[model samples]
Target: MKTAADIIIELIEKFDVHDAGSRRAHGKGEHHKARVELNEAGKDIFGEVENAVVRLSNAATNDKVPDWLVNIKGCSVRFNHPLRPIDIIGINFPYFPFDSAAETLDVLYRIHFYLEDKSAGRFMDIFRAGGLYRDLGKILKWMPKSTDMDHLYYTAHSYGGEHYKMKLDYHPGNDRIEIYAEKDEHLIDYHPGPAVHLGSILINPHSTGKEVKYFDVLNAPPGMPPNGNLPLLRHYVYKRSFLRRMEEKLLDGKDLRMLEEVWAEEKYFVLSKSQRIYDEIRELVKKGTDMSATRFRELLDEAYALKYEEKHLRNYLQHVWGHFKDEADESEKAHYTRLSEHPDPEAVNTFIHDLAIKYKEPYILRTTMVKTRGRS
Candidate 1:
């Protein structure tokens, strides 16, 4: 039985032989067009049911993989029983390719040519920091094209538990490519079964899940779902939910500013606070203690009893106001005017406390009560 390392070594050897032959036939430096030739023997060894091809192309002169000849592979697979032109196999690279075939081979061979290794992990880290999908979009255009295939499938391992899969359909006569993906829940799995197609667990005989859903990539805004910054998406959702709660409460300007301050404070705590703080707060609220206006003031005072850092508070308020300024309506404008008047501190304190209870966001009560020496 050939291990993954063995398989990779075999494939590299085959690619070397083919590359040398191509260089000889086309004359050195003359073969500008990239080519992908399938190796049936290597495919069988790699446990691929269909043929796999070695794709040779010039790597982009960028920070990702500067000035190198890249050799990657894609499998040829037929889908649907009476297979139509939808058959395609997408291959995802584990890391950015090195500059030359020798450099690439050396890096892979050093890692025993395994897909998941420290080197591969480093490559993935760099790839993600460099914008995973954006870099992929550039490489996809350089790959060999086939008229027989209707879609190109690309897959990658994510830092999260799930994997990433993208299906790209190129226009018949142009450079435009339409991207699609299986439903988010089905795209990746932590405990993936032997055959998990999209989100359905195929190994279980009693499974009755419907076919996976796919959505057009273009429908989502740039830097949003399907292929965008997940953290940014999460933050956006949190902000929207927070804003909605504020609207429901009809919070005044001062009230909004206080909540925004606490939110900023909580953001800083994400790096230092223990899960215990979050858990304890959730449990405290769940116990259903009366969190009336007085109780709210008590919590606020307890969280920020010292001299409050007015500068930090003002900065956060301005930052949030800037975000909503363009979208502010007449009512919002009036609220801002009221807030600018600086309502009584006791009233503002009560409002902040009430908001904490109402929204179940205790972190908002935890503000920097004291201004440190030498700081504004």
Candidate 2:
């Protein structure tokens, strides 16, 4: 049976969207290493936020479409946390037409359809489900028309279910904002919304030598697991898109460091699981041992098993909490249920991290996800 995810992948392949399985929908964009400080209000919502990485892209019809011509803009912010990082994704428009990922996929179809047919009549379908269609004004308003991101208001319409819903908004900045490079976090939240200001993004540009880093769309904060059909299908598209992009980069002989780092940290063999095994191998190297292929293979296998345990254990704790809670003592059960239902946003990741690292020490690593910038 062709599930929604299967259909999404098919559409991605059909249009040959460059950034399909990644960035949610913002494929063509720039990434920046940003410093995020919470305002008094923001601090209340998101405590002690570390600096972050941001992706700013044009939510245009295609890669060839100009940023200003696009009706929407996409921004994804990833706070720097060794484990259990938070990802807040949003668009320039105040509200998204669709409430879920499936709706977003429909928007994608509408976009490609409009582009191919070059007909507003088709795109402005009154019967179109969710987004733009029902609101004729919005349909025209959200067409690609932004002059630039500096003055544009980008919003994160993300919901961590009912328990954790936040409004992370960016204020409208002027030409001076873009004119000056490396604008700090305070400049744009220069405040964008009614809610607490959610820091600013310093869009980092890359030149010849610099490396381009990408945020992992899969890594959602605890208590905010992106489950359900929409997320499933959306993630499928993201994964496939990323893999395709990586493959293309490989073929083009582009630097693969970023991909390697993403895989090491985010993918199957995460840093925590593999780092110790790597350290063991390092010790072998320091001792001047032969370090045969068999030994290396064994270490990799160990890392693989450890990673499997990490994944399965996380799943078990989050989903099968009821069964385990039944067996545990009162305090343990309460703790499990509290976290399972409504977790303390600040502590959940650390708690999960502690559990995952019960045997292994936490592995903290950083990667530029790029190389050099502005090479002549």
Candidate 3:
């Protein structure tokens, strides 16, 4: 039986072939480097790096990368492999800057600029602060679906002689599959969607003994394709069973209805979660509680865990907390009059409760839905 990895590989190969054909039809030949010149900032930042090449192509589709691929131009990067001795590191993006490849290049240039000045730590700080990922998510939420071939993007990084490859699979759904690999070892799989908290699965699927070991891709000698053909059948079986049991409980009428409502008003839930934290903080203020960042995070974390009851909620709660803090700070300056940053809690709660009558929308709405159903 073909594993998910095999399916992914086949999809990628199909995309490449289709893309090549499209380019030929358009009278455009593949260029070793993109035609658009990087700005001064891009040149300055990427100048120090050897063999960094960027390419813009419309071949990327919503199902394989960023869902906004239809509205935005997308690009991929190739550079020296950071952790491995491979000739190139592939950097893929499911989504890039909206409507402009130039904008995408600018963002990459900005990232490199920070990297050059302060190294990796500052680079990441700037990336997050700039709202790159958040903005991408917002755009993705509204963009039309792409009808093109699905493709995977590759980006590489290196630290302490360790090479890491990041892949974004734009499968058809609200969420994308994010894969992180170090050398030949698959490290992490991140799926972002309604059950986002249940999506982070770590695996070392190829170890012989009980001790899970990471496997390397087949790109060791250069010019060889990366290999993801690990013995994943057992791992898949275990995960399927685990998910089945979880879903049996979580997707029953009552629970499924609640989840459906949550998915429907996901935006409201995020806002309400933030507002509730602020309301609690206001009450705490009355009790002379310290409104320090530490305390704020603690309260938000507690509330999020209580409501979501999933392990991955913490990751999102942190982001929400950050937004809350910013909103609170603005409210302090009288820039906002509302006590809460979100809508009324009663209304939000009622909206969720009302969803109990509408549970037939879809039980499992995700790219992995078919795979899970097949196992059963």
The candidate maximizing lDDT is 2
C-alpha TM-scores of all predictions? 0.24, 0.55, 0.20
Which of 1 and 2 is the better model by lDDT? Answer: 2
Model 1: per-residue lDDT, tens digit, 192-227? 223222211011112222211111111111112232
lDDT of 2 at 303: 50
| lDDT of prediction 3 | 0.31
Question: In lDDT terms, how accurate is model 1?
Answer: 0.31
lDDT of each: 0.31, 0.44, 0.31
RMSD of each: 23.4, 11.3, 24.0
Checking candidate 1 for backbone clashes, the offending pairs are 68-99, 90-153, 186-199
Q: Candidate 1: how large is its RMSD?
A: 23.4
Model 3 TM-score, all chains together? 0.20
| Residue lDDT tens for model 3, 82-119 | 32222222223322232222333345455555645867
- What's the CA error at residue 304 for candidate 1, in Å? 24
As for TM-score, the candidate ahead, 1 or 3, is: 1
Sorted by TM-score (best first), the order is 2, 1, 3
Q: Residue 113 of model 3: what lDDT? A: 59
Question: Which has the higher TM-score value, candidate number 2 or candidate number 3?
Answer: 2
- Lowest summed-lDDT stretch of 10 residues in model 2? 367-376
Taking the tens digit of each residue's C-alpha lDDT, what string does model 2 give over 1-376? 3445446655666676444323335655666666666556445444467566666667553566666666567666776655445566555554334446567667668766876786768667523856354566654664445456643333323334432323334443411111111111221122222343444444334322333444443455433443233433444455444544443332232324444444444322323345456566555434322323244434544554552244333443463233233445576656666665554423444443433323222232121110000000
